[model samples]
Target: MKADVVFINGEVLTVDKHNSRQQAVAVKENVIAAVGTNDDIKSYIGEQTEVIDLEGKSLVPGFIDSHVHLTIYGTNLLGVSCIESHIHSLEDIFTDLRKKAEETPKGEWVRAWGFDQLEINEQRFPTREELDQISTEHPILVIRTCNHMCIANSKALEIANMDEHTPDPEGGIIERDDNGQLTGKLIENAHMQMFKVASYSSEELSISMKLASDAFIKEGITSIHDAGAYGKGSETLRIMQQAVRNKDIRVRVYAIMGSLTNSHDFVHQMVQAGTVTGLGDYYFKLGPVKLFTDGSSTGPTIATRQPYTSDPKNSGIIYYSQEDLDCYLGNAHKKGFQITAHAQGDRSIEMLLDCIEKALKEYPRNDHRHRIEHAGIASPDLQQRMKELEVIPIPNPVFMYVNGDVYKEYYGERINVMYPARDYQEQGIVAAFGSDAPVTFVNPLLGIHAAVNRKSKTGQEVGEQQKVDVLEALRCYTINGAFASFDEERKGSIEAGKLADLVVLSESLLTIDSARIKDLGVELTMVDGQVLFKNEQLMRPSGVRR
Candidate 1:
């Protein structure tokens, strides 16, 4: 068959077994037909083929963000802006909120995310009274960057019936003052009380998913492993599944189901209902069951081996009991489902590794592909266990960029030990990189740049010794990400008979200076022979010549 589209005069990094870099590539019906020198690919091009001169640009496999919060990111993008900007004080936060209120209609709930108390001068959660002073009528809720915590204005607390007498629920905390009055801060499952009352409609969730899909495609992301999917409603999941079936989604999604109040019952029902891991086709698939083992480091809520240097009274909170976790894993493993546990601190990582090791020994299933999402602080011994068990560690490299300052404040000299990506590599563990969007930015280049530089988003170095090279960072986003999702054979590289998911870049990342890597731009993104996003715009059929 004649080639449908041929890209010539380009540097193509194939990312194959040999790491072969080529000059030209030809595509026929979405699969790569040829990858070789310009003269070699020219034979496949015919009069009907559309030729694109890359102008000495670069081409590689479409990026796969191994961890992301699609629904949450979309909701935040539409709701309010709090990321990628400095809010130094309460005055600055109120200024931004007041501006948003002006644009938003009165009485409508004002939902915002990505606030970090540690980043602000006060280093404290804003109170309900502070927000009520701005607007008593509107229900304003601002989520912390961790997503494990949030602060609700008085209106929101009233709507949720949370008052001085309201008791803290299991697995969550409602911060209270010395006088036993609610302080507007909610952590973990307690955040759900207000969130349930503030949840969006199915229509709104659908819009959010569409918006997130568009954003991912624009950044050359053809596939993403949604880190957590919760409270978006069953209808929202159905809408996403249907969109994938109809080929409406431009990128593939591997969605990890969120933990529930009765997680064991939930996983049981989901499995019995015929939902299995790797259930669907290319566009959508059932990933692992997500469990939050602990909280975020910035919040001083992560379960650590030692007490925080800043907060002597606190160690951290555990979301699940040891018995509950073991039971959940055992049942899920029996049902042929993989588990991806969110563990950040050293203690949390160690506990989860123990559970996984015990479960594998008891269950003994081959190809389980169990993973630890955000194994940020693994000790040397734990690293050896991770490699021995072949468990995957999906780290958020973007966190290093966005939260390094907070790390310094909380852990002091221990900041280097946190987010040990280089250690994972040295121990021969399969470590993948992702941008936990909404907590950080969604751009993979920024994540890769942060991984390679070990520099914070504020342009300061945190763990200079742990820095990786550009090619290694790229593998974390591409090949290692594919391994995390079990899609290595079909995607993650440019090869014959594989799906034609690719990204065309304005510059060659391999040849560029490390400092300038973040400036790289995506010129085009293609998924399964269709142009999804092109040059900061959505691509339509008319613009693409087949």
Candidate 2:
């Protein structure tokens, strides 16, 4: 039978067992029909087939970001950028905020995200007073890059009814000035209050998701395991389902319900309502329920055993105690739902291990594939426990590029095992790499670069011994990601009969300069035999030599 499409004259990295290399690949319908030499594949090409010559480029399985916030990633695109490159100082941030305030109608929220105090020239969080300078008439919110913290303008703080008199919520901090006045800065659970005044409609979420998905395809990502669904779970779930039905989904979406939204009570409610995993096909499907044990390490709020070097008194915070986590995780585990918790610090990681170990002892379910997202800062014993339980660690290596230096400033001597890549692999753990997008850049290549380089944005190495080579990093982004989703057989590798989700790159990572890995571009991205993105100029006609 003639194939639908054929690619020839390329270094086709079939990332299958034995790590085979091929010269050509053929796609038929929505699956890979053949993987062989150019002569063998060319024989299957017939009239009406779209023949693409890679012209000596590299072709591998499409990237699968094991964890991300798709709608959130998309929504942030609409807000003020406020990245290091965009705004370098508090003045620059205020200017952008004031600009957004003027553009938005009065009393409406003027929202901005992705601002890091460390990256800004001021090297401090924007004060409530500073935000007021932008606009007191507008309720303003500027989310930190870490997303665990945010600063609200006075109007926003008032809209949420937060004041100096209001006591701190459980495990969440509300920052105040020296005079004991609200600084309008909220950390951890306190940030949830901002959702009241600043909210996303289903319409907005759907639109932003499309935008984010489109961007994902351009960067060669064929699938994303959405960490937290849009807004809460109910309305957002309906919207996502509708997006899938209406053909609005750009790439494959495996949604993980929000931590609170997928709570014990909520999971039972959802189960009673006939909502569960395996409800949809490849384009969209329900996966696990997400839980957050602690905050981000970059926020310095992640629970850790050792006090931070910068703050000797602080050992970070844990949102849940041992009993609390067991109750939350046990509920979902009993419901036969996989759970992925955000465990960044060693303390939080250990606590989750304790909970998981207890849960498994009670239920004894094997091959559950429960995951620990951002499984950062593991000690030797903790790493051993992670392997013993077969819990997959979805670590975002790209953090090395952005937060490597910050990690050192906090953990100091203990930085060696932070976000361990080689250790996980060496100790027999199914470790996958994900972007956790909008938290970091969404490109897998950059993640690959960071994994291979272990270098910070400023060229400082935090944990050089933990670095992995390009192949290992690629596997973490590809097959290991699929394994995390239990969809390894269907995709993830360039194997015959597998779904034709492949990406064509400008060069092979193995042969390139490791430092320039992030600079490599995706020439084409294919999903289910359909080319979702293509740099047309890069594709040559059949029979064309490299």
Where does candidate 1 stray beyond 4 Å?
Answer: 84-89, 95-108, 120-123, 246-248, 259-268, 536-546
lDDT of 2 by residue, 1-546 (tens): 999899888888887867788999999999999999999898888887888877778899999999888878888987788874767788887888778888888988787888888887778888898888889998888988888889998998998889999888776889888999998899987785557446787778889878888999999999899887423666677777788678677678887766332233444555556565556788888887767788878888988887888899998877767897888777677777787688898889998888888889999888889889888888899999999999999998899888988888888877788879999979979898899898889999999999999999999987999899888888998889888888889988999999999999977766899999989998899988998887666554443322
Query: lDDT for each of the candidates?
Result: 0.79, 0.83
lDDT of 1: 0.79
Model 1 poorest 10 in a row by lDDT: 537-546
**lDDT tens digits by residue: candidate 1, 1-546:** 678888888888888877788988888897888889999988988889887777677888899998888878877877766654666776788888888877877777887788877667887778888888878788899888777788988888898888888888776898898989888899877885566677776667677887888899988898999875446334446777776676555689987765423334455566667677888877898888777788877776888888787887777888777777877766677778888788888888887888888888887988788898888767677788889888998888778788887787777777776667888777778888878786778999998888889888788888777788777778888878888888999888888888889898878888889888889889898888777767834222443343
Best by lDDT: 2
Instruction: List pairs with backbone clashes in candidate 2.
Output: none
Give one clash count per candidate, in the order shown. Answer: 1, 0
Quantify how close model 1 is to the true structure by its C-alpha RMSD in Å: 2.9
Q: Which ten residues in a row have the lowest lDDT in candidate 2?
A: 259-268
